[model samples]
Target: MTDNEALASASNSAIAAAVARLAEASASGVPRPPVRDLIGRDDLAAAYAVQAALTERRLAAGARTTGRKIGLTSEAVQRQLGVDQPDFGVLFDDMAHTDGATVPAGSVLQPRVEAEVAFVLRAGLADGPLDTEQVRDAVGYGVAALEICGSRIADWDISLADTVADNASAGAYVLGTDRRTLAETEPADVVMSMSVNGTEVSTGTGAACLGDPLAAVAWLARTARAFGEPLRAGDVVLSGALGPMHPVSPGDTVTATLSGFGSVTVRFGTGEAA
Candidate 1:
């Protein structure tokens, strides 16, 4: 075979291996070697390919796609990841929880929590450029949300490609009961405070999420469209974290409150049947 063919073969192998590792980690709740090590570092396209492949595998395995989650939209998170832009991942039906739900700690490895604004889209978004207003108009309502992020990479040691390939380090999410349309409230002015065990730990505003949470959602819609996956009606989009993320442990109760949007709570418990 020619050099080009050999390179393509090797790349395909890496993607397949990475997908297997992610599945193994998710099932076993164990960290795996970073995909950046298997594929070359800085190969985000390859990493996304791996993410898409694994997501498809998940869909085939009976997991239904619910929506998408945006990550690294905050400057702080981007700085931590050493990236200038944000990344995203698919959200499945099994990964969703309602407010006051109990999440099994054993189901995820190295889990953390971040407060966010979630949008329930009222209309399907086409594959193309979308502005913040268009995104806002498409939203049926917004809710206070907490993204439970987990990493399959050992000790959360990950590069851009590593996290991107690991389904954007997504675990599960909890959504608040109360919801409001954009006309009823300002998405950019909402303030979020996250508390663990009844003690406040992190705080931020909607502006922390790429200036406005709607903007992040717009970016996600456009980005997904570019990837051949358009945002559909009824899809819940978890706009990136409003501030820094905090670690959570079993028996811990985490709550996130958004100004004017009410609050959502999640309780963690020790190993339970998946």
Candidate 2:
């Protein structure tokens, strides 16, 4: 066997092992140790391979791919995670929720919430220049969004690869109803404020998301295409957090207001929020 091909086979084996470890954690509701020991701590390719394997398994089991989510767009978050570049993860249909929906507890392990702008695409990103302009043109509208992130790695002790393998640490998402076209709402200029039970906890502007939310989407489009799976029409892309993500407890109400895009709120099911 060729040297490169043989090494790839070994890598694939390692990725599969990592995927199984994470899946067990998710199924058992017990976070496991970092999978980085299997897939090198910085081996993003192998980590993504684990992600793909898990995604395929889910798809085979009838779980539908709804969209994609970008992570680490905030410079502060990037610094906190010690990564300069961002990562992407696939979103499943089951992870989506509407405004005012109550997310029950125990569904997400180690839940943390962050506010973002979500774009619903009007065109496919398969054959485009994958630039900011093309990304903006492809968007049907933007809405306020809240991403409830979770980790399968114990205590969230994860490297970049570990989180990537855990589907960018995605948990659930909530979208607002007041949507507006790109011309109607300038995402980069919008301000964000997130409160829990009427107390403000996080605040930021759309520009905090990789300078502009559109730029983040453009990056995701290019990255996904390079990975040989470009985004499709009608996909909902969750732009990375505009600020820091805050953890929640049972019965906490999370309400995020995106100035131009309106607000999105999610209630923890009586005692369910992390």
Candidate 3:
């Protein structure tokens, strides 16, 4: 192999090994050292390569791809993560849950929840710049979704590369039953409120997510295509969070209610932390 190819292969192997270590940490419910710390560099390209390798490993192990998730869309989240733009991650079939489901707290490390809107696509979208209307038209319906985010990095100390390498810190997601077409409602105006045990914790609007949730979906379509993976039909894309993420623990019952769309609830089981 050429020198450039040899260097690329070495980097890929290093990233793959880091991904495997993180997977072990996830399985054992323990947070591992950040990949940046282990590799001594913060390269976004290398981080994405690690994410792709881990995703391929999951797929090879029989986990089916369900869709994609957009993260760091809200200004608040961006500020929190110290990033200027958003990131994308792949979602698998097993990561999806219906409304009112109980999530095993042990399955995730440093679990948190965010309220979001989910787009169920009816047609495949190709790579290219797309308008909001185009993105809206491709969606079969939109539903209330609660994204369960977890970080395998110790104490959630993560940079952009760290989180990206960890699949955008994606854990699991739950979607509400209420579905509506874009024509039925104004997605930009939809408001969402999240509560834990009957007490409100966070509130935000659809505009908080990249100005409009549909715009975030459009961005995902374009970005995924640029990465050589276009969004497919039947995919459920989780538009980024409308508000700040709320921490959850065992016995916590979190509910997110969206205007026009129904509410979704997830109860955490009594699994001890690692």
User: Candidate 1 at residue 182, lDDT?
Assistant: 89
Q: What is the lDDT of residue 157 in candidate 2?
A: 88
In TM-score terms, which candidate is top? 2
* Global CA lDDT computed for model 3: 0.86
Q: Candidate 1, TM-score vs. the true structure?
A: 0.93
Query: Clashing residue pairs, candidate 1?
Result: none
In Å, residue 22's CA in model 1 sits off its true spot by: 1.6
Clashes of 2: 1
> How far out, in Å, is residue 24 in model 1?
1.9
Candidate 3 per-residue lDDT, tens place, 1-274, comes to 2222233333656776777888888678789888886443456676777788778789999999999999999998787777788889999998988899989857768988999999999988884456677787789999999999989988888888789889999999999999988888777898999999999998999999999999999998888886778899999999999999988989999999999888999999886665
Ranking by TM-score: 2, 1, 3
Model 2, position 77, has a per-residue lDDT of 76
lDDT by residue (tens digit), candidate 2, 1-274: 2222233433666877898999999899999999988888887777777888888889999999989999999987777667778999999999999999988877899889999999999999988589999999999999999999999999878789889989999999999999999999899998999999999999999999999999999999999998878999999999999998888887899999999999999988755234
- Using lDDT as the measure, the top candidate is 2
> How far is 216's C-alpha from truth in model 3 (Å)?
0.6
CA lDDT of 90 in candidate 2?
97
Candidate with better lDDT, 1 vs 2? 2
TM values, all candidates: 0.93, 0.94, 0.92
Q: Model 2: runs farther than 4 Å from truth?
A: 1-10, 270-274
